[model samples]
Target: MEAVRATEIMVAAGARELRDGQTVVVGLGLPQVACVLARRTHAPALSLLLEIGVTNMNPVDTPIGLADSRIFYRATCWSGFLDILGMNLHRGVVDVGFLGALEIDRFGNINTTLLKEDSGKLRYFNGSAGGNDVASLAGRVIVIMRHEKRKLPTAVAHLTSPGFPGGRSRKDLGLRGEGPQRIITDKAVLGFDRGTHQATLLSLHPGVELQDVIENTGFRMETPKTVPATPLPTPEELRLLREEIDPKNVYLG
Candidate 1:
């Protein structure tokens, strides 16, 4: 069930966007799964700009990381780590960015920094790489995370990377383009209300009810009278997702 949820979220995240020839900046974890699935299933020609600087890589198997050999073997160019942020991302060339967050607020601020403040205990989880640049530069940002009260918060404790940054801060900073367009999770799909930047329930998964989604969220959500169930994965999509993208089932675990 957890594997199904992870695959569903990855496929939903991949299905959101990526025109046939657009370039996307992909992060690790679920973002990697979605990017590969996008290339294989929907946008075959989509160019993937990996965090470690592999541009336009099409891999038979999902690479473990940016340094994976498949990246260099399939890339148009392999750039240095610094070049990805200082040059490519800063240039606004990436059409989309797929990211994972520990906690995401209603305004779309993401926190991957730390689970707890004084925890040298959680050091393994406290890394923020390319998230700031991806959120800032990508034309569109898609966040994939587990839907739980702990992960979906009214406000993030720390803003490792700002997406909406709240209306006031965004307006004051004169930021352009809508940030963090959508968040795809295990139980439902959510989007930021255009007027308030507050999270709005867009739809729910099959067998998932409104109460199930609402119970997981930390705040009151404005839901439509009718929320549709997400479409089930096609046979081919499911097979490809399980075999090629996540053979080891890392995401499922």
Candidate 2:
């Protein structure tokens, strides 16, 4: 069996947030791994809606990206981005969405566009490929990313996807569903404050300290007086994550 790793632990943590029978709109990378693990273990009835137009695919292998051929294997329906993003997402049918951002602010607004500049020109990372739609329209959104001061900024240099912008309701922005609900990181799981929508420390990862979370965060966050440790991955969950879901540790790394 593969040794439990930080990335694997993060994936397992993210998977626990999903419920069976929910329609999950998934992005590439760690989000994909988490959704796949959930489907195989706890959320078997979970329907995965991909950004690149595949839905409910019983995928066999870990896909590197949304366009990977493996995503279409045993897929239930075949469509284009227009039908998936415009039809289903626009209709607000995606119950949960898994996303990542280069930088995320305390309010959950994401920035994936540009991190730095080279040669006096802006250096762009992957642009918003349904991130805006997913964050805006998914019934709930979960962001998975490495926990670090640089990645968790007080404010993103630019906002690529809106998340309770200025603590306004989704309806106020003409969006259909609730905005970001959770952020799963390497060291902690952060949830939004119910009233203010600011990031709040929900739980610390095993062996991680509240001070670690605060020191790593670039901006001020709501810290609980006593943060319970996040539940560790069970033996069975770790087994399936290593053997069935990602034997090669493609995304577990």
Candidate 2 structure, TM-score to reference: 0.95
Clash-forming residue pairs, model 2: none
Q: How well is each residue in 97-186 modelled by candidate 1, as lDDT tens digits?
A: 888999998888899887754653553465578887788777778898888997988888778878777544454556544578888888
Clash totals, every prediction? 0, 0
Residue-level lDDT of model 2, residues 1-253, one tens digit each, is: 5556778778888999999999899888899888888888889999899878898887788777888898899999999888788888888788998998899999899998988654667778988989988988889999999999989988887899999888777778787778898999999999998788899999988888788889999979988888888888889888887778888877885
Top candidate when judged by TM-score against the true structure: 2
Query: What does the lDDT come to for candidate 2?
Result: 0.87
Estimate the TM-score for candidate 1. 0.88
**What C-alpha lDDT does candidate 1 achieve relative to the native structure?**
0.75
After superposing candidate 1 on the true structure, give the runs of residues whose Cα lies further than 4 Å from its correct spot: 1-6, 117-124, 169-171
lDDT of each: 0.75, 0.87
